[model samples]
Target: MANFIDKLKPALAGSREGPPTSAASRGPSPFWVMVRKEFGDHIRSWRFVILLAIVVLACAGSLYASVSALKDGQSASAASGEGSSSFLFLKMFTETDGSLPGFLTFLSFLAPLIGIALGFDSVNTERNKGTLSRLLSQPLYRDDFLNAKFVAGLLLIAVVIFSLGFLVMGMGLFTIGYPPTPEEFWRVVVMLLITVVYVGLWLNLSLLFSVRFRQAATSALCGIALWIFFLVFYGMIVSLVGNATSPADTAAASVVIRHQDWMMLLSRLSPAYLFQEAASTLMLPDTRTLNPFITQDQAYLAINAPLSFGQSLLLVWPQVVAIVAETTVSFAAAYVAFMRQEIRSRS
Candidate 1:
């Protein structure tokens, strides 16, 4: 009996349970299990909690501001009062149906925060946890881990965006004391779609950083640096070049016509900016103004040379494709890096 016990203990030394895991026991779609596990791990992190808090706070601010605006509406002499609570809230919260400027602006402004949170430590954490080798050991295909990470990040994005949008919508419904019209709902949906794409771009960028950097902090800083370059300086460069290329004091028609070339050239360079413009177009169908370029008439006129809804899609296709393709490339790179990485040399 003693001899048998010693032999059994040796067999079970590394096992977590009674039975050895067989291919059959591994079950169907291990990728899903991996994604869910990643999701769970991320949601529990302080970073996720903080990110959710920011979005929740934004929603709450909208509601509180709406309530204040409502309480102050119609008191013109109140000095702090706006014309209407509902009006201001609608202006601030409503998606630009055929305009992408404000939504893109918001995303450009907020993207670094999201990107840093989602992927700052993607590779290093596995290395630190001593799980990279084991994760690579799973019987799934070579790319499954990478695929699972992207899927999990996307799910996280959906949760954050929809939650904030719904919260704002709820407040609007209550404060205005009426349900959203179909148009508004659909506009919100488009805005949400844009949000998904915008966040995806950042996630991909950060994933690249995650793969290339050995330290989590270095990856995070590099990700943020990239965001700053694209969001902050990219527009400055665009505007400067556009102005440099332009003729001054032209008629509004010619101003638009001539500037359109420069602006399109400028905007296309950054998917972040293009996404903002496209979001405005898709979400703010009824927008009276989107940035300085789009007037109420121009918003729907296809004047920016979109030519058609299909053209608009084509114009923004790079942003959409960049996001998905960037994610695939980054994840693939991470997989390759992990597979080739020597675990023994890892610190």
Candidate 2:
């Protein structure tokens, strides 16, 4: 019996020397492990909790405004026989009681803050604490770390955005006792997706700054500065340029069209403008032209006619694509920069 046990002991030793057949060995990969860790950290962070509360309060205020406005408009719409033709679900998003902006407006303004807050210190915080080099010292690829951080932030954004969307829908349903039509529900879903992409742009931008700057505050300030520039100053700059280069009042139709085209190109450079344009078109099916210069013939064809779901999507595809492209560019820049960045352990 002793000889037989000894013979089997070498086999067990060889198996232990080889890859251990344990559950830990079969667990998630290193990339996924990093992703989970980052996700957990984001969820438990105080900044996220505060931002979430602010967003919820703002969204609730806007929602109440919308619900009140809808209730007040119901009588007028019913008397005029417009209630049946109107979209109640969409109104819950776009309507307000003259006190607050609608849900989309609030989301557009606040989503960037959430993205920026979540990502501004993603890398620099680690480096400042002398853990970035230690983290990279593990059996993890450089891209995996960066990619995991981005994916984790994006996942958090999606969770928050989608939760707010459904909350609005649920509260509206409970208060108004009306469910959205299939088309309206899908439109809302698409708008939520666009909001995610919009926030993602800021996330990647801040992540880029986090990689480039050693200080978290500097990264955050840089992100906020760009956000302010595009939100407030970019539009003014575009308008000033448009006014300086405006065609005369008596200019030819083609010349005026050319001028408007130039202005549109410049304005579209702002992601907020693109998001607003896309959200408006999706939420309001009556929108036919992104530019204010629709021809008489085109206007005649669109009079009293709402666009179909597919038509609305087609109209805003460029804006959606543009936002996506900008996000991709930002992420790629960050990825390349992080890969090239050198990390040294602090003694």
Candidate 3:
């Protein structure tokens, strides 16, 4: 009877010759395999395909729109007098200027949508599809799963945002019939960086929301609601507060507003707004008016602020650090939340 049972055990265990297995000897550690499998799964996902398609379409659309606008300008340029062709084209784009305010407005509004799309179901879908426990049982740190999601999200943003900027520049040159000037080139570069950061910031933001909520519907709704509040309602409320607190006297109003500077300061707290301010500083001339706080004098001072790009980097290093810090804190909280969740195997 013992011999027969042993023979049956081998057949049931899939080899008829293998040794007994134990949890302690699963070969690779959990963390590495999760990361490895995650990378593979990321590339193979429908999300990846959608991301690529969105990138191509969004960039192509922007290029087409800008070029069509530029082409319409070309006919008028030949007939009417111009101080300089470059100057005229500059004026048109200046109206369309890639200043911080403009960049922030466009990117802040656009990015949350991308964030929602990428993260709304990141974990819940896995949980619903019944892969969560099996994935958790693997030899990986609990945090690794979240990390893989973040890495994939950021990489996708980098690829898409970068291509958009390059295409915009190419279309600009085609329309202008000359390469961008030194100042113009920096503006475009600044625009590109902020676009990436804006999109990437929301990657973690949306992911954090996704992980913290259990019901897929709850997560998706919160993710989108948070985006709306931050992007649209935050500004509106800030403006309302400013208005509600305005002084009775005109002179006091101006002076108090200047002294408080709360509106401008409050604006900076929004990564969206800060990104705009930074972009404005990078892209606009000394005269650009992105914020009331940054006057012509302040703008000039910033431009002439005895610093190389490296030095400026160090100066704005706080903002960069702040962004990193915020993303890290949110993601860390989400990581802990996920690790604490009950793992039920549905499949």
Against the true structure, whose lDDT is highest? 2
Instruction: Report RMSD for candidate 2.
Output: 5.5
Ranking of all predicted structures according to lDDT, beginning with the best and ending with the worst: 2, 1, 3
- Specify the highest-TM-score model's number: 2
lDDT of each: 0.65, 0.92, 0.63
53: Cα error in model 1, Å: 0.7
Which 10-residue window in model 2 sums to the lowest lDDT?
A: 16-25
TM-score of each: 0.73, 0.92, 0.72
The lowest-lDDT stretch of 10 consecutive residues in candidate 3 is 95-104
True-structure RMSD for candidate 1: 6.5
lDDT at position 337, candidate 3: 82
**Candidate 1 whole-model C-alpha lDDT, 0 to 1:** 0.65
lDDT of 2 by residue, 37-116 (tens): 99999999899999999999999999999999998889778899876646788989999989999998999999999989
The TM-score ranking, best first, is 2, 1, 3
